[model samples]
Target: MSRRDPYIIRRLNFRKVVVVTLISLLLVILILFAFITESDIPFNLQNRIRVHREHPSLILVDLMPAFVFILLYPMHRIMNRAIGEYEDRVKESQMIVDRNTKFARELSEGEDPEPYPEMIESELGKALRMIQLNIKSGRRKEKEQTWIAEGKDIISKILREYHDPGELSYQILQALNGYIQATQGAFYVFDEVEGRLTNTATYAYNRRKYVTQEFRIGQGLVGQCAYEMDFIHRTEIPDDYVTITSGILGDRKPGSILLVPLITNEALQGVLEFAFINPRIPKLTIQYLLELGEIIARTLLNLKLNLRTRELQEESRQLTEVLRRNEQQLQENAREMQSAQQKLESANIQLENKIVEANHAQSRLHLLLEYASEVISIYDESFRLTWISPSVINILGYTVEEMMGGKDMERIGRNDVVRIRKMLEQLKESPGRIEQLEYSFIRKNGERIFLRTYCRNMLEDSSIGGFVLNTTDITESKQVEKEQRLKSRMQSLSENSLDLIMRLSASGMIHYVNPVVEDYTGIAPGSILNRSCGDVAFQKEFAELMGRILSEMNRRPVKKNLQATLPMLMGEYRAERILSVDAIPEFLDGELETILVVGHDITEAKRIEKEIKVQNRKVQDSITYAERIQSSILPEPAHIRKAFPKSFIYY
Candidate 1:
């Protein structure tokens, strides 16, 4: 249908239809005039027939504008219907935005909300209301759960975050006012330091300020709430009510207050005061604030507990370090004590060994001094005898008991005792020695024996420990030595005289024959020495005489003379000889029983005795001459007769 142009179809209107209809009518009249002028049967009937048949296409075109108007007329009603529906939808969307904005704002403030408007209610309001309710319920559940699970953590945090209860009280007021969409309220915190309630948080319209004034508990509405430990809801405030924060709230001209004490299990920690921007807030709205206030209280308690726990943890760590240091010091002290004990034990062992060695040395010294032949004694610094060796009992002829009792000193000669004391005193001052001095000591048997003493001073620290005495008995030795000298002189005289001197062993062998033996027997000692005296001498009987002499050598008083007659082998003779003999047995050349004999020859005297018969008469005559000399010195017999007439003189 490219043939139809609607723009062209719409351009023709009723005025154009009128103008085109007039021009068509005028044209038909002109065509009819030409047909009638040509003379046809009846002119008037001819016009009517011509009009019905002529211009059928022009009549169809004239009806096109009317058809176009009918068609465009239905489109105008359709356009108006569409415009009205669009306007209604716009109004509904605008209402939804307004209602949702109100819902969001109310929910954020924690207000008890009303339903949305009807316009939005049929659209998105139902869903939004359900979501808001769920949000509120979830928030309440979450708060309760946190209070249970982390209550202590919350209390500790609150105590750390807000130093003063008043500061926290203001936070609660702000929270309440924000939720209610009312900008007026007050908060009272219990000031335990000041022992009163302080108005802390306040809001009036768009303004906020803190009031530091305090009131006694039960002094006003706020105080009364803390004192009673209960909440006060006052919708109509009395004229006489005490006002603590007066000019702070804007919309709360003289609004009524609700005072609630922030109570825990313990006494009141703080109090809260609220004023509605209006005379009173909704009951449900205040209840909502009350529930939130409970959360704040629980959090404050938890904050206190957690702060204490953290402090304890720090303290425990410090204590552990101190304990570790103490343990280390104790261990070091124990080690030092053990080392000291070991050193003491080692020193004790060495001391014991030294004591043993000293005792052994003392025992040996005692034994040696006891067995010595010499008498040994020790004295103390006071000159009192302390100890003497056991040999004193044998050598000094005294018992140990006697010596210990000072009896031995009493037996010493008086002069020797004095000398010993003087020597001891000198040794005490200056220590020295005294060699072999003769001292006499009386033995226990009352024999005064000569003692040869050797003494030395024993000193300790320049003072006399005592004196040591070494004594020997020499009385018998002196007697024996005197006898030996006499024997030697007699032997020398006999050897030079007309006598025979000889020494013989105990077995009768001749040991020595002096020169006199050769002169008498005409035999040299060389021929007679070691030969039996019986064989060398003239008679065997002489050997028996020599044997008898040697046997009696040790006997006392060997001075004896004998007369004998013998014949010599060199000449025939019967001559008489007088012999004076001395014999001694002596130890010679380490052999026992050697005899010394000295015999004098008086043979010439025997011859003179034979020649003179009056030898006995001469001995008698000499006795008469000795008597006559003795009478010369006597008084006369007459004198004796005159002196004693009654007595006869006996001559």
Candidate 2:
């Protein structure tokens, strides 16, 4: 139910009070009248009341109960005030409750609820706000701690990941800069010998001030930070300083600068300078940097030490190598003398072994070349055959001695000599260029043999005087290629022919089909391959025609030409086509193996013939009718001759 207005409720409560008070007054008055006039009055009191009826005290005392009604007005006023005050207290309590509820709801919804009433008398509100502030503060502290930990983890990883001093400094500085959201940063490694700092790496430095950046101790902020081994943070930056940028364009002036010294074991390793766009860097990032400075310094120092140690070890190895080389030279000299003596004694023995080994190698080589199908030959710059394998006789029907002194053009086919010369010239232009030429060579028996020569030009080489040729007889391959060409041409013509062609086995199962069958029969060639042409799905007319033709062939080689009208499915209708098909049978050893059927579409031709016949019949009937009319209209041959001596009737 909806709440009633406070004034209305107050009025209703006041009316109830007034009614009860008046009713009580009326009851008292009635009771007073009954007691005063009835038996409750004593005889003496009744006589006194009659005698002093005019006296005020006697009348007042006798009608005191009736007089109680006088207090009703004041009582009404009192009860009205009391109820109004009660309503006010209730309204205040409800408003306070609502306010508290709204405050808690807003807090739960992650709203600031800043303008809400925080009455001083309300202790709960104060306590709740306190709790919220405390939780927010704690969360912020936790987040900062996490952020710092993350930064520290990043730096620690960078330190452990790289060993080179330059890379280590660069990666750590870059990480620190990004973790702090700095606009630009630079890292400088200190040179201990020169007591100076050298800028090693930079992160997004827009303008480099020097080609080789170097600063002596106490020269500038970078050097001072290294010399003093302390961190410096500057918030009031000069206006003339470089503008800050993050992604593409310059945004604004940087508001702060930070220089951190890298110190470990009382030795300066490097210095890091970072610039941030914000006036104040986050304490978490600052703390992270301060804590990581020593780690980075230690890593850099370790890398430098390791590099120095590696250099020292390399130098030592070089010294050792020098000494060992000296010792090896002396030993080599001594061994050379001893080997010279030994070689002098074993010279004849080695010569005999070499002769025997050469003879064995020659036998092996000759045996390989004798049976090898391919011939390996060497030619000079003039294209003269210097060396030819023994297999040349078997391959080209020529003895090795007969081919050795001949020029290449003398044996090559006359028609291909020009092509061979061009190929040879190309081969000679570039040494070590391998090329192949297929040319026919004239054999000793006056037969032309094709050779696929794989030649490599080595014209200027001392070992092989001219080209190294590997020739393989390809005469059989050439004949097979020619036959393949013929077969391919025939296949091309058959497939592209206008007539639909199909080859079937003796039992009428399809063996092969050309693509044109799809246009004539509305059937895909591949789908009908190896399938019977007498399937029920085909048009009944075609099936009957092929069936009759095949049946007749089984009995005897009857009519080979078939004329049939097949209805083609055209969308929602059927189009009848007249196909004149011819059956050709192929026999192997006088037995039918397969039959080839050729279908020629003649739908247009049949339509034109039928139209012409109809037109001719109409013309002949009209001509006979005209002749009859002309004879009927003629008066006589005598009348026409009288009108004109040479009158003639044209029909």
lDDT of 1 by residue, 1-651 (tens): 122333234344434555655665566566656655664545686554564467455355445545655665566556545655665676667767777778778877877678745734554677777777798789887875564445334444544577455565555455456655555667655655355766666765556675555666545566656755656666556444445333344333455666666766645666666665466666555555555556666655555466567689878887677667766688775786798799899989977876775576457545655665567777777788777778776677887778989876798867778888887777677654443477767888887777777666665423225676667677787557635653564456545556677766666677667787765556777898768766765454455566566555545334444434444553675543456566655663344546667776666776687768678888989999988987897778889889988888665
Clashing pairs in model 2, backbone N/Cα/C closer than 3 A: none
**How many steric clashes does model 1 contain?**
11
What C-alpha lDDT does candidate 1 achieve relative to the native structure? 0.62
RMSD of each: 73.9, 34.0
Candidate lDDT (C-alpha), each:
0.62, 0.72
Residue 55 of candidate 1: its Cα lDDT? 42
lDDT tens digits, residues 226-342, model 2?
A: 644667676756454343211111345567888888888767888877877778876666667777788788878888888899999999999788667777688776776798799
Q: Kindly give the stretch of ten consecutive residues in candidate 1 with the minimal lDDT sum.
A: 1-10
> What TM-score, to 2 decimals, does candidate 2 have?
0.41
The local lDDT score (0 to 100) that residue 361 gets in candidate 2 is: 56
